[model samples]
Target: MWGDRGRGGYVVHPYRGYGSRREAFLMGRVFRQTALSDRIPRYGVLRDLADVLRRIIRWGLPEVSVEVSLGENVTTVTTDHDGYFDVHLLLEHPLPDDTSWHHAELHVVMPQAEPVHSFAEIYIPPPSADLLVISDIDDTVMYTGVANKLRMLHRLFVKQAHQRMAFPGVAALYQALHAGPSGNAKRPILYVSRGPWSIYEMLEEFFQLNRIPVGPILFLREWGISWRKPWPRRAEDHKYDVILHMLSMRDDLPCVLIGDSGQHDPEVYARIVHEFPERVRAVYIRRIERKPDRERAIDRLRDEIRHTGCDLMLAEDSLAMAEHAFEQRLISERGLEKVRRESSR
Candidate 1:
């Protein structure tokens, strides 16, 4: 009697996820549609404001049971107080090698509410995958002005996906990395962001609109804030945990970590290198700020972590990063040329 379908309509927002042959994880939310509609309100200042507000001001259908199935695996999970469910799926056998993408079925089950079904596409990297790429979304890939709260908020609320810009040559560089050294490895690129889940759809549209290579997963954070704890927890802590968990899952694989010098990415990525030096092939920090103090700080960090065997590069542009990757044989010559061409245009 008390669901979105009862009053109007409810939706299961299943996020794109990634997995291995043995296990997979998918996260999603259940929300009741607003009085208007689920789609974003169109092109006016007031409409944009309403669009941003509607995303953040969510009414989560909490504590409801959900059924998640992938391949031969099937499980049930209950949404948290915020209506977010993390589906930890265990497969009975390895996923078939014929395909890389798997669509998982999500069924919502709650008392008095009609059972709603949704599909989540999960990417399982093929055996040909040589390396994994984990990247930051905000300042590293796009100009979100994440270092400044006011600018960040303004950009987030006021801009449409087309209005949101990607850093120059990013799409080309990412496509190169996706192609890998031999130019066809089709390596898995997993993006991890410090942003909230509310902005997921916007980010997806931004990637599509920018011609950026879409990652199989966009791991985002959940800020469970309250009046008593208004500040919430440290976001870097969440990032640290997420990276470590991804690293732990595939022991044989090596990954390249990409992030920006802004905020705590330098420190967080350095921590990852220090802990799992063997697992990390390289760490690239995009130079978003030109402050001397920040430059000195990153320089010092680079020197300190040199002994870990993975070099940290402070890239001036996407081309610089692509060049370094080419030299390392992490990307092919054609990939480097692509970035160069894109950067020029």
Candidate 2:
């Protein structure tokens, strides 16, 4: 879900979902927004600040009814006190055997009011896919100093999507990974981020602006200060939980995990490798700092996962990663050449 709108005295916020052939899940929020909040622009520092403030002061519609349908399967659910609603539906039959995304519709079925309609998509990986690519967003794809709160906030509020700079060669590398060894296979790419759900639209715009392969964005919970709660809440084991969920959902597909050394990626990924050794093919961590301690720590993680036969590469640039991918037969020579050509620019 990218944006929210008010209709028939209700505010509806839709969120994206990912699934396989036989099952799918849909999520969204129902709330009421203030007039001032509704006026906030979609870009600029002022707009960013306003978004944070609005999320804190927003009014949630508790016990609201929601209807979700994909083909003949339909389900009704109620929003919690926080205005969050999640509906898991079992499809009557499998989705079509195609690489394209499937569509699902959601309705805010409130009593004595016109239904508010929103749409979301479900991505089904093709059978020809040999590997899945799961990546981190903040420091790995875009330049967000997640280790430094002040710089991160500055980058977030001051830069528009077009103004945000992606790391060199990262887009080409991801595109190659998306098109696997055959250069035509539509390998599924999933992005996991520590960012809140409020920035979903901004992130989507950033991906498009930078030519990154779009995928299901799994974001952590929203955190904001409210009258009832004066402080923001922190998520515990969020990355681990989300990654585990994704791995469990697509157990048959081997995955290549991509992240950076900025935060707890090494630890989380190391644990995943230990637990599901056979499911992981390789782990790529973009080097962010030149600190000896960080490198030593990542090396230790590497040693820990070495027994799983999943190679751990701490690369300084996307070109290095692309070369390694080609060597591992994950991407073709043409894809590697494309990545090299794009990175040289």
Candidate 3:
């Protein structure tokens, strides 16, 4: 689920199910775009009620649906009786970076006299020679969930401020990537996420508080329960219009896709490789949870990697990937060495 906060809506975090599946829950925040009513509430103070409503629209709650994409295929799931739903993304052919983007749309239906409907798109741009690592802040690179399953579900919907912790070494790794000399280049290290748009200030505060590096942050504005949020505007109708739009802007650099194994990265990257065989250099997947038989799964995906000729890795830390990138001369020695030092510490 990926989204933002506004008067009328919010986007949810973009989710990916285990392997080739869409995440179980579609996350979004709902808010009234209209100004607060001047009338006082029957019980609570008018101002207090208005404030609460603002938070709800900004970061509290929103409704949505699940949409998953693998290669050219797409699957959609709706909320159940409990207003929850789950769908898996099937990866028959892993996409490569050159493939440009893997486009998927999720439909959200708000229960109303005239239902509100919305759509979401997952766009993965081709890698830049300088490399761009677009990632989600939640499960992809964090271990805030105490008991894994229980906490993960809670954080998935609630946006618990305290539970928002970074994965081991991720901060240091990102810092090294951005702080080192090579990182000062003109190309951008974009952070496009599905987290609340209103929370942008909060996220900036968190990044500074946590000493995380700065980058371009793009957030989706959450539409109503039924209203669909379309992908970034593009003139072309190529399924991967958004990503292509982003990639097309930068013609000089190849790209490297980084994400977790939880959701659409595998499928998205697979299609990217297929679409733009020349633009992507590698795909680095953080080995998060919800996986089945880790050893067997890695072995199988490894074979698939051999077939695709893409550098696929399951790393415990971004530093490990940085090390590989350094070895391949993808990153400058100073940057690689900095990551190594930070990771080792």
Q: lDDT of each prediction vs. the true structure?
A: 0.83, 0.80, 0.50
Over 169-258, each residue of candidate 2 has an lDDT whose tens digit, in order, gives 988999999998887888888888776665666788898888898865455476654678754578758778877887888888899999
Worst lDDT run of 10 residues, candidate 1, spans: 1-10
lDDT of 3 by residue, 1-345 (tens): 232332244333333221112221123222224345546453445544454445444333224454555556666665543233445444455555553334445444454523333443333332433555455454555443433656654454444333367665666666555443465542334554444344444455455556665444443333233226333233222323435544565555566666666655565665666777677777777767645675356546545655556677777676878887666556667777666676676
How well does model 3 score by local distance difference test? 0.50
Candidate with more favorable, higher TM-score: 2 or 3: 2
lDDT of each residue in 1-345, candidate 1, tens digit only: 012321336788899988888888899998776654546444566666776666766778898888988877889999889888888888886677888889889998767778889899888888878898999988889899987888987786567787888998999999999999787887888888877787788888888888887878788887665567755466758778888888888777899999998888889999888888788888999998799999899989899889987889999999999998998899989989989999998
The residue pairs found clashing in candidate 2 are 1-14, 1-15, 1-16
**Prediction RMSDs, each to the true structure:** 3.3, 2.7, 12.9
Best by lDDT: 1
Ranking by lDDT: 1, 2, 3
Superposed by TM-score, candidate 2 places the C-alpha of residue 16 at a distance from the truth, in angstroms, of 1.8
Local lDDT at 155 for model 1: 81
Off by over 4 Å in 3: 1-53, 58-129, 144-153, 156-163, 179-183, 196-198, 221-223, 226-242, 290-309
TM-score of each: 0.93, 0.90, 0.54
